[model samples]
Target: MPQEAGLRSFFLAGFECATQRRADGKRLDLLASTRHDAHVAKDYARIREHGMRAARDGMRWHLIETAPGFYDWSSVAPMASAAAEAGVQVIWDLCHYGYPDGLDIWSPAFPERFARFSKAAARFLAEQGDEVRYFCPVNEMSFWAWAGGDMGRFNPTARGRGDELKRQLARATIAAVDAVREVDARARFIVAEPSINVAPNGDSEQAIADAANYCEVQFAAHDMLVGRLNPELGGSPDKLDIVGVNFYPDNQWVLGGPPIPLGQYNYRPFREMLKETCERYGRPVIVSEFGAENTARPAWLYYVAQEVAAAREAGAPVEGMCFYPVLDYPGWENDRCCDVGLFGDADANGDRCVYAPLAEELRRQRVRFEGEFAAANDERMTPLRREAS
Candidate 1:
């Protein structure tokens, strides 16, 4: 982990803020649905109590810019103020798979419009007392391209156009970085995408090669942003900063088959994936989003923490791990509750019940990290110790 990243704590809380429209034409606002928007002050304070002095949140572009060239900060101002007041450092997501209505994602003007929005957002955050701004220009570009473009599961439902959608997202991301930098040159960016492993179901040579190729597609967006691939999109190394690898238990799967069991022979160790990402990008990496539902939560966190510890010892620049959706949210497709957060759904008073098992596991991991890093005299441990204490 680089000291320059300046994360306030080793563990981070990620609020579920996806504002995507489903295939059924229903737009979802997770922040609102989870009541985090209304209770942001209490939410930030709660995370601090849990030793998470930093968070990943989002800005709803649709609500902020309801019309062309018009800006509204009413929806975001309170959250920003709460973070500042609670002393929680936030990495804002500019677009979490949702955009303004009537905006054509394929048109040249799409990137242009997003750039302007990014500029405005940067300036606004700066004005709100965020001296050093951190932003994820677009969350999970590869996943979004596949879900909305290739699978027709979300907005702009089109099939067999994943690559084209990915390229356009790359263009938008590049434009956003430039636009943000124009507002504040010191602004940092996190390009978060899902990290996965695809295994061949059979021993056939063609199946093996196909699986490998499919796995490689995960890096297309990162490569594009760094100008390693699709240089025509105007990507350069500067556009790529911190690499955020979003991993879940189901990330590894057999080609054309079901998910690989956790202890299966073909299931890749999370450490190896973390190390590969760091080496591939030559930049700081963070487990930007990761969590499991119900009873699997504690075990999953334990697995990830141990793997991250091993990765760090092996010289991977793993910076931080974010327990995504720190507050449980309603399901995107169905309104059913997803019991995956450290905190349950908010009550009328904007308070939530803590999931004790996961919270205990998180505390244990924090202590373990503090001890290991302290023994190694790792400078990065300083912030963790200070925050956790």
Candidate 2:
């Protein structure tokens, strides 16, 4: 298998690994609830057959660290061993918006505790081996702050503390990166944040100004991590390594209003958004989370993949794109079946129902890239590139 710098593959599968508390004070473990935790080895092997050799999975902080300082690797070991057994690489997410009980987000101990947890996780994974090292210390910091703090939809449920929560998350993330580095200096961190575009409804200058400001808010977490917004967070250029951006159909909108439908006149160009992100961060990027529901999956992949290709062609250091939530997961709010994965729920044999449309599209894209995706100077890839092919 070939690699592009820190990534093992140009395409990757991402498991839906969100573990958070809901508004009603109920905990949601999508991985265990979906039985993904039970079939990590099988899942990794199967996706490798689909031509992807890398994945993004998460560690359940709440589950692993049952007690304050004690941890049980029983929950995360199987996945790490499975990836190695299958010869697949992984990018692990340390804190996917969930924390151990009795840990207050507002307390001074939150950052310290999270950092300690990061060190423990890194040490354990390093013991597993040296092949798998990429990590997202705190996944979706901006979204977490908004959903959990501003909107009061999840843990750390505070109605008017979005900025405060964001700052806290940034501090924790920077601390985690440093902790992981202490364990393995070779480890790379991918700061996964969402990319969004907002526009004004009318011709009013104030409306345009408001929309622009709202649009820039999407970069707050990243900016803070890079010490551009909040230098007090201990963030610097070192903390801003690989940029992992999540984008979706609902990511764009009229500021403070309705969503801008994908492919419509009001929708902004994703290629431009990607380019701007690379320009702003000065790091290689990965579309860490992107997919649509049910029947729209294929079309969405096609659109996103093309935009990613265009971004690469335009000289943005886009390293890879991950088909997020490669396995279908239960919705957090309603427990509904979100048919947005290449594979549906597993059966008695631990086999999942394949979404044929998505599988076919994935193969088609994979074949094309494997046979035709060489760059001007990057020769680590196989087959001829676009112009040559």
Best by lDDT, which number? 1
lDDT of 1: 0.90
Where model 2 places Cα greater than 4 Å from the true spot, the runs are: 1-5, 372-389
lDDT of 1 at 114: 98
lDDT (tens digit, per residue) of candidate 1 on 175-280 = 9999999989999899899999999988999999999999899999999998999999999988888999998989999999999989999999999999998888
Angstrom error at residue 297, model 1: 0.3
Q: How displaced is residue 104 in candidate 1, in Å?
A: 0.4
* Per-prediction tally of clashes: 0, 0
- lDDT (CA) for every model shown? 0.90, 0.85
Candidate 2: clashing pairs of residues: none
True-structure RMSD for candidate 1: 4.6
